[model samples]
Target: MATQQSTGSTLTRAWANTALPTLGAILAVALWWLVTVALHIDPFFVPSPADVLDAFMRDPGFMMNETWVTFSRVLIGFGIAVAGGLLIAVLLAASWTVERMTMPLLAAINAVPKVALAPLLLVWMGFGNSPKIVMVVLVSFFPVIVSTMAGLTSTPADLRELGRSLSASWWQTFVKVRLPWALPQIFVGIKVATPLAIIGAVIGEVVSPDHGLGSVIVGSGSSADTPLAFAALVLLAITGVVLFYLIVAIERLLVPWAAAIAS
Candidate 1:
C-alpha cells in the first residue's frame, strides 16, 4: 500500500511539473495566433502559428534531410568532444601540475568566443565536416573536462580514509572510492555539454553547411520567410529538449542511486 502511494505520488509530481509548462506553451501559441490573426501584423514580421505549422507540414522531407545532415554533424562533433574530454579529464586528474599549467590557457581559450574562429577555421579546414567537428570539440571539451575533474576529485573524505587504512594504492583508491563518487558530477558536465554541442553544431552550420536547421534558418531569413525560419527554430528547440532528456535518462540508468537521492 505504501509502495503504491509512493508510486502515485511520484507520478502526480511528475505530471504537475510537466502540466504547467505544457499549458503555458499552449497559451503562448494561442496568444501568438491571436496577435497574428487579429492585429493585422505582417506575416513576415510575426507569422501565425498556422503559417509555421504549414511550412513544417509542407516540407517534411526537406526537414528530414536537413535534420539528418545536422544530426550527423552534431553526433560526430559531440563524439570527438566527449572522447577528447575524457582523455584530458583523466590526465588532469592524474596530475595537479598539468592541471595548473593548463588552467590559465583553458580559461583564456574558453573566454575567446569560438564562433569568431569559424571563418578562419573554414578557411583552413575547408568547408568540410572537419571544421565543424573541431568546433564542436573545442566548444564541448572544457565543460566535460572541468566537470569530470570536479567529480573525480570529489572523493568522500571517509572513503579516502578507509582506502588509506586498507593501504590501497592510488589506482585502487580511484577505482574503489573516487570514480563512483564522481559520476554524478561528470554527468552534470554532460547535461551542460549536450545542448552546447547542439548549439555548436548549429553555429557551425550557420557559418557554412550544405544542409541543417541552421542552414534552413539562414536560407529562410534571407528570403524573409518568417514561417520557415520559425519552423527551423522549433526544430532546433525540439532537438535540444530531446537531447537533454536523453542525457537525463542515461544518467538515471547509470547512476540510479544518485538519481533516487535527487528525487
Candidate 2:
C-alpha cells in the first residue's frame, strides 16, 4: 500500500507539472480567439490562429527554407561562441591576471546592446551571412564565459585540498575535479545562450540579410502582412525550443550521474 501510494503521488506530481501551464496557455489562446473572432477586429491588427497557420501552410516550403537559413546562422554562430567561450574561460580560469585584465572589459562590451550594433555589423560584414553569425557569437558569448568561470571556481575547496595532497598538477586537478563540477553550470549558461543566439541571428538578418526568417519578418512588416510576420515568429519560437531541448538532451547524457543523484 505504501509503495502504491508513493507511486500515485509521483504520478500526480508529474501530471500537475505537465498540465497546469499547458492549461493556462490553452485558455489564453482561446481568449485571444474569442476576442478576435467575436469582436470582428481587423485580422491585420491581430491575426487569428487559423490565419497564421494557413499562412504557414500556404508557403510551407518557403518558410522551411528561411528557417533553415536562420538555423544555419544560429548554429554556426553558437558553435563559434561555444568554442571561443570555452577557450576564454579556460585561459581566464588558469590566470588571475587574465581575469583581472579582461573581465571588466568583457562586461562593458557585453553590456552594450548587441542588437543596436547590427547596422554596423551589416556595414562591416555585409548582408550575406557573416554579420548574422558574428552578431550571434557576440550575443551568446558572455553568459558562457560568466557561467563557466563561476562554475570553475565553485569546485569544492576540500576537493582542491585533496588534489593538492595527492600532488596533482593544476591540469590534472582541473580536468579531474573542476571541469566535472562545472558541467552542470556550464549547461545552464548554454541554456541561457540558446535563445540569445536565435535572437541575435534574427536581428542580424533583420538589419542586413534579404533571406532567413528574420528577413521574412522584415519583408512581411514592409508590406504589413501580419499573418506572415506571425508565422515567421512561430517558426522562430519552434527553432529556439528545439535547439534548447537538443542541448538539454546532450546534458542529460553527459551528466547522467548528476541526474541519478537528483532522482
Candidate 3:
C-alpha cells in the first residue's frame, strides 16, 4: 500500500509540474484565436490556429511525408556529427600541440555563416541528401568538440596522477577515469547541437531539395498559402522540441547521476 501510494504521489507531482506549462500553451493559443477573430485579420497575412489546422488536415499525407524526410535528414546528420565530433575531440585531447595548431582554424571555419555555404555545398554535392547531411555536420560538430574537450581536460590533476602512480596504461586510465567524468559535459554538447542539426537540415533543404518541410514552406510562401506555411512552421517547431526532449530522455537514462545532480 505504501509503495503504491508513493508511486501515485510521484505521478501526481509530475503532472502538477507540467500543468502550468500546458495551461499557458492553451491560453496562448486561445488568445491568438480570439485576437485574430476579433480583429478580423486576413488569413493570408496572419493565419488563425484553425486556418493552419484546416490546411494541415487537407493533405496530411503530403505534410507527413515531408516531415518524415526532414526528420530523417536531421537524425542522420546529427548522428554523424556526434560521432565525428567525438573522434576529433579525442584526437585533440591526446595532444595539446595538435589542439593548439588546429583549433583556431576550426573556430574560423565555424565562424563563417553556414547558410552562405549551402549553395556551394549544393553545387558540389548536388541535390540529394549529401549536402543536407554535410550542412548538419558542419553546424552541429563545433559544440560537441568544444564540450567534449572541456570535459576530458577537466579531470583533476590528482586523479590523473593517481592513475599514473598505479602504473595504469594510458588507455586504461582514460577509459576508467576520464571518459566517465566527461559523459555529462558531452551530453550537454549533444543537447545543444541537436536543434542546430535540424536548422542545418532545413537550410540545406531550402537551398536544394524537391522534398522536405523546408521546400514545402518555400512552395507555400510562393503561392501565398500562408496557412499552409504556418502549418509547416508548426511541424518544424514540434520536430525540434521532440528531438531536444528525446536527447534529454536519453541523457537521463544513460547518466542518471548527472541528471540527479542537475535536479
Candidate 4:
C-alpha cells in the first residue's frame, strides 16, 4: 500500500508539472480573446485565436506543406551546425595555436548580423534551399562551438592526469572521460542553437520568398490576410517549442546523468 501510494504521488506530481504550462497557455489565450473581443480590435492589427484558427482550418493542406518545408530546412541546417560545430570545437580545443589563430576570425564573422547577410546569401545561392540552409548553419553554429569548446577545455586537470597515469591514449581519454564530461555543456549549446535555427530558416525564406512558412507569412501579409499571417507565426512558435522540447527529451535519454545533475 505504501509503495502504491508513493507511485501515485509521483504520478500526480508529474501530471501537475505538465499541467502548469498548459494552464498558463490557456490563460494567455483567454486573456487575448477577452481583450480583443472587449476592445473590438480589428483582426488586421491583432488576430483573435478564433480568427487564426479559422485561417488555419480554411486551408490546412497548404499550411502543413509549408510547415513541413520549413521544418525540413531547420532539421537539416541544425544537424549540420551541430556536427560542424563539434568538429571545429574539438580541433580548436586540441591545439592552442589553432584556437588563437581562428578564434578572432570566427568571432568577427559571428559579430555581423545574420539578417544583413541574408540578401547576399540569396544573391549568391539564389532562390532555393541552399541559402536557407546556410543561414541556419551560420546562426546556429556559434553557440554550439563556444559552449562545446568551453566544456572540452574545462575538463578537470586531475582527470587528464589520471588518464595519462593509466597510459590511456588521447582518443581513449577524450572518448571515455572528456566527451562524457562535456555532454551536458554541449547539450546546452545545442538547446540554445535550436531556436536560432528556426529563426535563420525563416529569415532566409522571408528574404527569398520561396516555399516555407516564412514565404506563406510574406504572401499572406502582402495579400492583407492578417489572420493567415498570424496563423503562420503561431505555427512557427509551435515548431520552436516542439523542437526545443525534443532536444531536451533527447538530452534526457542520451545523457540522463546530465539531466539528473541539472535537476
Return the top candidate by lDDT: 4
lDDT (Cα, tens digit) per residue for candidate 2, span 179-198: 99898888889899999999
Q: Tell me how far the alpha carbon of residue 143 in candidate 2 is from the true structure, in angstroms, after superposition.
A: 0.4
Question: 130 in model 2: Cα distance from truth in Å?
Answer: 0.6
Can you write out model 4's per-residue Cα lDDT over 1-263, one digit (the tens) per residue? 54565577777878887998999999999999999999999999998999999999999999999999999999999999999999999999999999999999999999999999999997898999999999999999999999999999888999989999999998999999998899899999999999999999999999999799999999998899999999999999999999999999998898988745654
Off by over 4 Å in 1: 1-21
Show the lowest summed lDDT stretch of 10 residues, model 4. Answer: 1-10
Better of 3 and 4 by TM-score: 4
> Please, what's the RMSD in Å of model 3?
3.1
| Runs with alpha carbons beyond 4 Å of true place in candidate 4 | 1-8
Reference-based lDDT, each prediction: 0.85, 0.91, 0.92, 0.94
**Which is better, 2 or 4, measured by lDDT?**
4
Off by over 4 Å in 2: 1-28, 260-263
Residue-pair clashes per prediction, in order, are: 0, 0, 0, 0
Better of 2 and 3 by lDDT: 3
Clashing residue pairs, candidate 2? none
| Location of the lowest summed lDDT over 10 successive residues in candidate 2 | 1-10
1-263 per-residue lDDT for model 3 (tens digits)? 54565678766878877897789889998999999999999999999999999999999999999999999999999999999999999999999999999999989989999999999997898988899989999999999999999999998899999998999998998899998889999999999998899899999998885889999988997899999999999999889989999998888887888855555
Model 1 TM-score?
0.90
Clashes by residue pair, model 1: none
